[model samples]
Each structure stands twice: as structure tokens, then as C-alpha cells.
Target: MASFKIEGGHKLNGTITPQGAKNEVLQILCAVLLTPEKVIVNNVPDIIDVNKLIFILGELGVKIEKLGSNSYSFQADELKLEYLESENFKKDGSSLRGSIMIVGPLLARFGKGYIPRPGGDKIGRRRLDTHFEGFIRLGAKFRYNKEEHFYGVEADELFGTDMLLDEASVTGTANILMASVLATGTTTIYNAACEPYIQQLCKMLNAMGANITGVGSNLLVINGVDALGGCEHRVLPDMIEIGSWIGVAVMTKSELTIKDVSWDNLGQIPNVFRKLGIQFEKRGDDIYIPEQESYEIQNYIDGSVLTVADAPWPGFTPDLLSIVLVIATQAKGTVLIHQKMFESRLFFVDKLIDMGAKVILCDPHRATVIGHNFQSALKATTMTSPDIRAGISLLIAALSAKGTSTIHNIEQIDRGYENIEARLKSIGAKIERVA
Candidate 1:
């Protein structure tokens, strides 16, 4: 396992560009399997999870060529179907949750898909029932091998049908949409996830000859097509990283500018930070956060404690809640954080509490944070990273703490953020990576 040793209380200045959206790249790369022609993707982040997915595709006989530092061409004209059943596939597919998305495109184009129980963050119980249910709704036969712990879906032909998902699950929606794009008739999806990532996926698919409508709403209508072709796509900037940078700037009293953050798609992220009284200015497409000694939290209209909660698209994302929670430790007031989607994600607050923050874990899903407002700096300590978002959150906390902090299992952070220590170092952060 890798470790990160971070020294606290350094002010950062200058501009940083957020990496390409990780979630979008996963779905987009999976969608490339739907086409037999070359699909050139731009702005693909060079992170471990993404590289793993690319390796999986390469093993499946998808011809890949690197066009630039962050661009690649993928052609799935010849695929190795039997590879999906091999022992190697089981090992690779089980390592990352994004591998599950490949099932959709494979089933849509090849009439069969197989997945060995996918693995991901230990945030909570993330059920795969919605994905299987959507496939079943579209005329696919779903089977589970209890002994091997494997999932398989197959159908000679898929006919489009109406599906109202139990929730607006992001990966679930992408899977269903990919499966339905080439089905025989019209497919209507109600209560769909309309996040910018999903919208971009739909747009890219439309460019490749998939007839999809209702781009930015909960309801999507897709007309089945005979075949899909090649298309070029550029992923949007990572909003989660932008939010994390905002928190870092606030915690370290730094003046930082994040470039081209896809301003319109951020939704409530900026406002959510503003509620904590963070000062940021949006100049054109960039977000500029100025140095501040301390920030105050804003209460509700009735002067009640402010509560920040995660919801579906157009609402504050659950991914940013961890950063918000850590930053709240230094804000001037109290706020409640509700991470409704994942139960155990809020449990990471114990590490922050160990470092001298006043936080109350109400339950698995809720935590109340009372800010220190910089009256006292957090004391450094050793901790283990539980997941990707939490890992970065702890890094932010460590950077603002008083002494030295050592974080183990930094591979979790590397899975999402690209060369995080080098990026932070470019902006004057005192972070060192160790083996």
C-alpha cells in the first residue's frame, strides 16, 4: 500500500485545471463497446480505475490507440466473447464497480453479458437489483450463479419497453439506456438520472446514431436503431474535484483559481459551499476562491441550523458531502450533513473527530458538524483511507492541520485522482508520497 505524508498550514496560489470527469469516462468508455467502428474519446483521465477498464476492454479484443496524452481511439469491431467467461475476467471485473457497466453494451451488441460480482468502495450496501431489473424489463433473461457469485444476462433480441426505475441510479440508468438504444422499438425511461454525465453520454450516443431525446430531464425516450457508428466525445471537467479544490482553498486560506469547471453543470455545488460562507467568484468559466482567515456558516431563513443533504441530479451530489463535512470543521457555525445514498460514508467523520473537530454522528446516514472557525487548528494523526472521496477529504484535512499527518491506503486516492501529490505540490502544498 502507498502512503501520503502531508504537512499542514500552507497557503496555495495560482491556477489548476480539474481533471476530466471520472464517472463520465467510465460510462463513456463502456458505451464505446456498443459501436463496431472507432470511437475517439478525449479528455480521458489517467487514473488507475480508468486504466483498469481500458485494459479490460483491450483484453476483450477492443483495438485501442492513444491519440494524445488524454485522448484515445477504441474500436470494438472484433470482440472476444469467451474472454468474459475466463478466470482472468472474473478477477479483473471484480476489482472495480465500473466494470459492471460493460455488461450493458455487451448485452446490447453481442446478445450476452457476464459479470463476476463487482466490487467498489465500502461506503454502504449498493444493490445491483435496479440494473438487472432494467435488463429484465427490456426482454433479457437474467441469471445468477449462487455458487460462483456471478451475474449473466442474455437475449436473442431486445424490444424496447417502458421502465420506471426504483431510483435515479446513475450507473443503472446508463446501463439501461445502453441496452435500450439498439432494441427493436421505443423505450421510455421515467425517473431517470439526468446528471450532466448522463446527458453527455446520451449526446455522444446520439452523435453515434442512437435516437435519444429528453436530454436534461428525468424522462428519456429512445428509439431503437439498426446499428451505431463511431463518434468523437470530450468529457466534461470533474465537478467533484472542483468542489474539493474549493474546500482545500478555504481550509488553507489560499487564493486559487480552477479553470473551465463547466460552470452550468455544477448545479448546487457552489451554492452549497456558499452556505458555509465560502467566498468564491465565477469569472467567465473559472472559479476563483480568495484567501480568507475564516468563514462563517449561514443558517436558514428562520435562523435554524443549516442542513446539507444529497439528492439526485440538479441537487447537491453525494460525492461532495465528504469535502463539505471536512471543511465545516473550520467554518463558524453548525450544520447537519445527510448522505442519504450511502449509509457508511458519514462514518469517516470519526477520523476528523480524532483530529479535534466537533462532529456528532447521528446515525449511519446523518452527521452534525459544529465548526471550529479556525480558532484551533486540527492536530495531525495517522489514519487509513476507506474510500475515494473520503481519502481526498482526509487529505484536505491533513493539509490544514497543524503538524504532520500520515495517510495509509493512498491507492484509494490514486484510483480517482491523477497524480494527486504532484498536482497539489504544483500549488505549494507540502505533500510527499511514500511506498
Candidate 2:
């Protein structure tokens, strides 16, 4: 596995562009399987997971042509449906959680879809029950084989129906939406995930001639269509990367200008950072964070401890809470970070605590961090990355620490962030990638 050896306490200054959305592109790439016509997508990030999904699509006989550095044209002109039964499918499909999304488009267009047990970050138990349940409600036969460890959904014809998801699952909504677009009738999905990723997927689908309504809302109405044509779609900038940049600026006390961050779509991210007493200026489409000597956390008006938690869309994203927690270690006041989505995400705090930050892991889901306010530098040490988000948070912590730090399992980081070391190095960050 590759690792990063970082020299800490470097003041960085430069302009950086946030990469295209990783989660959004995951869904958009899967949507290509729903149409046989050519679909062009722009602003695609060149990362491990995205490339893995692209390779999987190619294995299914999707004709893929690279248009540019950040663009690709894909056509499912002649799919090799039998490839799903091959060992190659099991090896490639099990490498990414995003591979599960292919099931929807395949089942919708070819009336059958097969997925091997998918693999991803081991933060928590990410169940596929919602996806299977949605497919079952859409008149598909769902079966799971424990021996082979795969899932299969098949139906001669899929018809739309009403479904209230057990939870607002992002992938679940995207999966069911893809299946419903080619279904026979109107499908009403309540408690749907309305994240920006989902909204972007719906927009791209509508452009491809799919009837979808109530975008950016929890209730979705998808009118089934006979066929979907091709369309060109540009993914929005990654909000998680933007938020990570913000946290890095504050933690390192560096000046940075993040360009074209799609300010309007960031939802509660800016406000949540503001609550932590981090300030930045918005210059048209860019965000300028000035170098700060120190930043302090804000307490609630009732003099209670400020708590940062995750929710669905239009609220704080769970993906960014780790960044918020790591930056909080250098602030002036105390705050609680409640990671509601994943149980094991907070386990990395022990490494942070060992680095001299004051932290209390109250339980599996909550941690209280006491800020150091630049009064002292964190002593760096060697650590292993637990997941993609946690890996970045640890990198940020190491960057702000006083001594050298080494982070292992950097493959987890590369799976999401595109050319992360190269990008950060351009901004004067002291990061060296080692094999």
C-alpha cells in the first residue's frame, strides 16, 4: 500500500480548483447503462473508484471514449450481459460500492441485473436492503445467494408503483430512479434522498428524456418512459472537497482561493463552518480564505456546547463531519461531533488524541474535542487511514502538526480525491507519496 510522509506546520498559499463531485459522478456513470445512445459527461474526476466503475462499464461492452482530461462519452450500444456471470465481474464488481448501482440500469434496460458482494469503506454496515426492497416494489424478483455472495434482480417487465423507502438512501434513490425511468407507469417515491447528487442525476435523466419531478425534495414522481435518449451533463464541483479545503485553510492558517465552488449548492456547509468561527470571503464564484493567526469555536446562544451533527440534504453532510472535527482541535472552544451515519468513523479520534489534542470519545457515535487554539502544535506520529474521509482529516491534522507524520493505506484516499498529493503540493503543502 502507498503512504504519505508529510512534514507538518507549513503555511500554504495558492488557488485551487475543487474536483468534480465523486458521489455524483458515481450515479451519473451508472446512468449510462440505461441508454443505448451515446451519453457525454463532463467534469468527470479521474480517481480510483470512478475509473474502476468506468472499467466495469467497459467490461459490459459500453463503448467509452475519452473526450478530454475531464470528459468522456459512453454508449451502451451492445452490452455483454453474460459477463455478469464471469469471474472478472466478481473481481471488478466487488472492488467498489458504486458497482451496486449498475444493477438498476441493467435491470431496467435488459430486464436482468447481477451484482457481486460490493466492497467499500469499512466505516459501518452499509446495507443494500433499501435497494433490494425498492426493486422488489418495482415488480422485480429479488434474490440473494449466500454461497456466491451476490444479488440478482430480474423481471420480464418492470412497472412503477408507490414506495416509501425505509430510509432516505442516496444510492437507493438513484438505483430505483434509474429502474423507474424505463418502467411501465408512474412511480411515486416518498422519503427519497434529495441530495445535490440526486438532483443532478434527475436533471441529467430529464435531459436524456426521462420524466422526473420534485427534484431537490424528499418526494419524487418519476413518470416511466418508453426510451431514454442521449444527453450531455456536467457534474457539479465536489462539495466535500470544497469543505476539506476550507478545513485545511483554517487548520494550517493558510490563504487559499477555491474557484467556482458552486456557492449556491453548498447548502449548510458554509454556515456550519461559520458556527466554528472560521471566516472566509466569497468572491463571485470563488471563496477566499485569508490566513488567520487563530480561530475560535462558537458556543450556542444558550451557553450550551455547540454540537455539529449530520443530516440528509440541505443539512450538514456526514462526509464532512470528520473534517470539521479535525479542524476543531485548533479552535478556542469546545464542541461535540456526532457522527450519526457511521459507527466506526469516530475511531480515528484516538490517533488524534495521541497527537496531543484533547478529545473524549464518549461513545461509538459522539466525540467532544477541546481546541488548542494554536497554543501548541500537534506532535505527529505514524497512523493508518480508516476510510477516505478520515484519511483526509488525518492528513490535514498532520499538515498542521509540528513534526513529520506518516499515513498508511493511502489507497483509500486515492479512491476519492483525484491527484490529491499533486494538487496539494502545488499549493505549497509538504506531502510526499511513497510506495
TM-score of each: 0.99, 0.99
**lDDT for position 376 in model 2:** 80
Candidate 2 residue lDDT tens string, 292-350 = 98887889889999999999888799999999999999999999999998999899999
Q: How does model 1 score by TM-score? A: 0.99
Local distance difference test, per candidate?
0.95, 0.95
The ten-residue window of minimal lDDT in model 2 covers: 293-302
* Tens digits of per-residue lDDT for model 1, 373-409: 9998999999999999999999999999989999999
Those runs of model 2 whose alpha carbons end farther than 4 Å from true positions after fitting are: none
